[model samples]
Target chain A: MHSKKVRIITVFAAFTCLLWIFGLGWTVKDYLIGAAHSAYSPPAADESAAQTNELKIIALGDSLTRGTGDIEGKGYVGYVTDQLKKEGLDVSLINLGIKGLTSERLAEQIKEKEIKRQIGQGDIILMTIGGNDLFLGGQTLTNITDDSISKLEEAYLSHLKAILADIRAVNTEATIYLLGLYDPFNEFPEGALTSKTVRGWNSKTMELLAEDSKAVFVPTYDLFQLNVNDYLFTDHFHPNEVGYRLMADRVAALITSGGGPR
Target chain B: MINLVQNEMTKLLGKRRFIIISVIILVLLSMFTYAQARQAETIKERLGTVDWRTELQQKIVDWQNRLSSAGQWREQLQIQIEQSQYYLDHDINPSEPGAPTFIRGFVENSAELFLPLLIMIIAVDLVSSERSMGTIKLLLTRPVSRFHILLSKYIALILSVSLVIFIFGLLSYIISAFMFGNQGWAAPVLTGFKVEGGELNISEVRLVSQWQYIIQQFGLAWFISLVVGTLSFMLSILMRSSAAGMGTMLACLIAGAILSNMVSSWTSAKYLFMVNLGLMNYVSGTAPPIEGMTLGFSLAVLAAWMLGSLVVSFAVFMRKDIY
Candidate 1:
């Protein structure tokens, strides 16, 4: 029995040895020559047929959209989804918000194939952009000149226009809630100037979104206008949980009351 | 020669090492499969859909978010993001959901350290155990020359390494298939993503079927395991105590794992056998642990080491005085 077992094992081992040698030889040949293996033509996009009965919410843009300052890590997007779920609405969210993103970057990001596909599948879209473009990570705070502010706003408005056009090209039906910028520096000594700049920035953005009938400019200026310090995180740039909750409450109220395809 | 190898095989079978190795593989594979299932569950719960494209997109975004804070890993993460975006553009699921995909990932991850350690379990004591039990004397006393005896033992070790790899593949397939199902053998896999100067160069990128990719991966894995086994065989010949041989090999392997993570600045360390063991990285298009390391370079280094160890093993075993 021992001899027979050894014979069986030896034969099995020898067979595997041959198999591995073949595999090894194939690897060497493939790596060295890399002969034109038939190029694979990808299958056509299947129109994303798996649309379930849930409200698909796609959140896009910068750190604010990413919930950078919220201790709970749920930015306004998360709060919006949670509130919708609380009201017996089924919602699925894909937050594609990266920190420090600018309007120009968002214009580039929405052109990506997968991002376009995702936007095409959403029922609602929430976005926060232009913060990095306008603030320049607080650099513009010290150099608050009219020339620099208009220069930033001019480039930003063009990028925002292109971004909205790209989103509408793929997904015309989704209600786009473009959250306007608020003055995070409302408590600073130059609070009046910064608030004026922020308000101008918001109006220009609101004007651009007004071209698209389905787009709504959700004002966040008033939310931070009164108690800027209370809503600001320690870094004094992004919103805390309470601030995000306030933002969520406004968007969630709009989403719940708006009449659209379920 | 065949009879000598058969004799060695019989001794190996009697030792019941294969049973132990199988048990170890089974336990590890079960844990991996469970963890994989839990991850899939979480992704589904988070996304509310099983669509792989959405998941891939989310992963890319997450990696991008991490790039700002990734410090030294920024370049690697950037390359990975580009590769992932390439897959997303081509509409090819990089990791198709099935047993074959599981095996491909498992083999790639284990080829560097885990599989080699398994090979060590058999190899570190191959000759040392015989010396410890005083069977070497009886073996040398045979009509067979010492060269033939050692050659037979080395051949047996090769056979055993091949068998262990086969068992690993088979067991992982069965276990993961039970959980993920046995599909996706024909899924398209993108390869040949070359990274030069921290930039992803896609000039030679091509798509191969998933089965071909898995086979090539296992091929590289087998070569890595064989190199590790050869070194252990040398240690088994050089050391008097099997425990000492095992301890030395374990330290070298763990050191290699840690070194590969931090050795980019120490470029010369790439010549070491431990650092070159991640041959799968070249095939998977991951940046090598050090610059200038390629498939050809790693293969040559490993082959040279295996040859050097074989020569040393034979020279020591041939002339050593037996007690």
Candidate 2:
């Protein structure tokens, strides 16, 4: 019986050994010979096939949209989703927010095939950009001047216009919520100057969004203007959890009050 | 020679090591399948949709968000982001939903460390145990030459190595198929992605069926296991205590795993057998532990190690003084 069992096992092992050797040889041949398999070409984008009943929220922009400063890591976007869920709405969210993303980068990012497809499927598109472009990581404060600020504004406006156009190209029905920047430096020594610059920036943005009927300019300046220090995070630039809550409450209110695509 | 090998096979089967190895694989596969299922569930719950493209996009964005704080890993993350973007652009799901996909991933991950350790469990004591048990006297007294006896044992070791891999593949397939379902065998998988100078080079990228990719992956994995088995075989001949042999092989494997992560600056370390054991990485297009380690280069290095160990094992076993 032992001999019979060993014989069977040996044959099985021998067969597997040969199999692996063939697999090994085939690998070498395939990798080295450079087989000319045709390159994969993706199918054309079918925009209408992805329709669903769930409220798909696609969040795009910088660290603010990414919940960078909020201790719970739920930025305004998270809170907005939470509130909507509380209202008994089925929601799915895709946050494509990269930290320190400028308007230019966001413009380029939205042009990706997957991002475009995601935007086409979204019911609500939330964005927070121009922070890095305007603040330049707090570098603009050192060289605060009308010429520099306007130069930054000119570049930003063009990029923002391009971004809005690109987004509209793929998704015309999704209501875009462009959150206006809050002046984090409102409590600084140059508080008055920074606040004036930020207000100017926000007004310019609002003017651009005015052209799009579905686009809503959510004002966050007033929210942070009063309790600037209390709302600011440790970096004194981004908003804390409570500050994010304040912003979320405003957006959630707009979204619930017929701001969303019904 | 055939009878000698059959004799070794009887002894090997008598040890029931294959049964132990299969049990180990079964236990590990169950844990992995459960973990994978849970992960898919969490992703579904969070996304509220089962669209793979959206999930992949979210992963890319999450990686991008970490780029700022990922001081040392920025370049690696960048490459990964670009590779993922390439997959998204080509509309090829990097991981399709099925047992084959699970097997592909499992094989790639285990090829480097886990599979090799399993090979060692069978090989580490193949000859050392004979010495420890004083069976060398009876075995050597046979009319067969010392070279034939050793060669038969080596052949048996090779056969067992192949069998262990087969068992591993079979058990993982059965368990994961039950968990993930049997599908995606014909799914298109993108391969031949090349990383150079911290950039993803897609010029050589092409599509192969998932089954073909898995076969090629298993081939490379088999080569890796064989190489590891040969080294352990050499140690078995060189050492008297199986425990010491196992310990030495285990330490080397763990060191290889660690060194592959941080040995980018140590270029000379690329020649080491442990470092070259990640043969699957070259096929899957992950950046090598050291720069300039190509598929051909790794294959050559591994083959050289295997041949060198074979030469050492045969020479030592044939002429070494027996107590």
Candidate 3:
């Protein structure tokens, strides 16, 4: 019995040593191979689900779409997604919004391959742009000027047109909803100048949309025009949670009513 | 010498130490697996209808922002960005909860801390217990030179350390795979980010299979465990009391872990063996506790300490009287 126990113990230790050596060998071999194997292409997505998703929302633009100001980290896009799910629609969202993306940068991003692929697969697309352009890209409010605003608006219009063209190039069937920017400086001393400039930008955006039957410009200027202080984030520029919800409610109503096809 | 080693190995193997350590490792692994499962569930619930692409993008940007302000965490954030970018670029969805990748992640994270502690537990009393138990005289009276006896014990300690780490890795993989699944070994992992002049140079990032990553991580982890075990072995020889040896080593290790984070600016702290023990961080492209501490530098520091310890231990064992 004593010898038998010793034999069993010997075998166990030997077996463990073998495994340890084996594991070490395997890792050493892999480390060498890994050094040589540098390029990696990720596996493809599930084909069946990828092709037949019921609803897909692709959002692009600046911090509002990125949910920067909202304490919950859920911008208008989150509210829209929740409302869509509540209404029993299967929703999958692709949001590609950088924090400080101007209209020009966004136009460039729209041409990128990843964004193009997402736009191609989207059933409903949403966007918010030109805020950084007209607001001097988060500069001090005193830096605003009527003449500079007009100059920024002209450049922003061409970029927004190019952006729309890029989206339409890849995706002709998706319902394109471009969200209009609101004036967070509506209660400030320069409120009138900013609102007027934002309205001019909106009018130009709406005119561009008029040329395309599938694209609709969702207006949010009126949404925050009254409760500007309440809707404004602590930064006094971006929209707070209540402001995003208001934007979401408007977009949700539009989608439920007629935007998303039955 | 070989016979002496074999005898020591037999004695070490026969002890209840192996059983206790294995049980402890198994219990901890199960707890980790359970917690991981719960976390995956919560993430799934929280994600709801958000697509993986948006989530990955958000995570990437968030890490980038964090990287800008956090000098200590740049390596981690850089790796996160690289991984997320790969997922986005290749159109591969981020890993689901309770997947093999998650298990691999857990193994990588715990190896540098838990694996070493387990090895320390077994090594702390290697020589001290024999002396305290009055077996040192019997050990000394043997025909073999005292050096052979001490060398045998040291070799046995190393073998046991390797065995424990092996068991921990294998058992962790098995248990986590059971909870999660055995898929995703083919998943691509990013590596090769290195720090140059205090800034991470992510230009050489490479993608290797998940299996490759686990194997490499295990190898590095084994090296770390070996270093830790040898340090404790020397302590056990010098202190002549298991508790004191183990306590001192543990305090130094814990203090090193803390000081590495808080005292990166203090140049003298760089020479601490504990500060240099995070060798895996260097292997994985994370910066060391102190600036300019490269993988080669840390390896050299550890090797010197290890060599110094072996010299001290052998000198003390050969000359000291067995009372």
Question: By lDDT, who's the top model here?
Answer: 1
Q: Higher lDDT: candidate 1 or 3?
A: 1
DockQ scores of the candidates: 0.81, 0.74, 0.31
Residue A31's lDDT in candidate 1 = 83
| Tens digits of lDDT, candidate 2, B202-315 | 888888899988888888888899999999999999999899999999999999999998999999999999998888877788788888888889999999999999999999
In order, candidate lDDTs are: 0.93, 0.91, 0.76
For each candidate in turn, give its C-alpha RMSD to the true structure in angstroms.
1.1, 1.2, 3.7
lDDT of 3 by residue, B1-323 (tens): 76676777777766778788889988988898888778656644553333566556656655644564667577656755765675577676556433557656665676667777888888888888899999888988878898889998987777787678667767777897798877888766666666666566766677666676666666667767777888899999889889899889889888877888887679888888888877667546666677788666766787788888899989998998889
Tens-place lDDT per residue, model 1, A1-262, is 2887788889999999988988888888888777586757779778846756889999999999999999999899999989999999888999999999999999999999889999999999999999999999889999899999999999999999999999999988999999999999888899899999999999999999999999999999999989788998999999999999999999999999983346
What lDDT tens digits, residue by residue, belong to model 1 across residues B1-323? 99899999999888888899999999999999999999999999999888999999999999999999999999999999999999999998999999999999999999999999999999999999999999999999999889999999999999999999999999999999999999999988888888788889898888888999888888889999999999999999999999999999999999999999999999999889999999898888998899878899999999999999999999999999989
Please give, as one word, the docking class of candidate 3. acceptable
Scored against the true structure, residue B130 in model 2 reaches a CA lDDT of: 94
Q: Write the per-residue lDDT of candidate 3 for residues A59-80, one digit (tens) a residue.
A: 8888898887898988999899
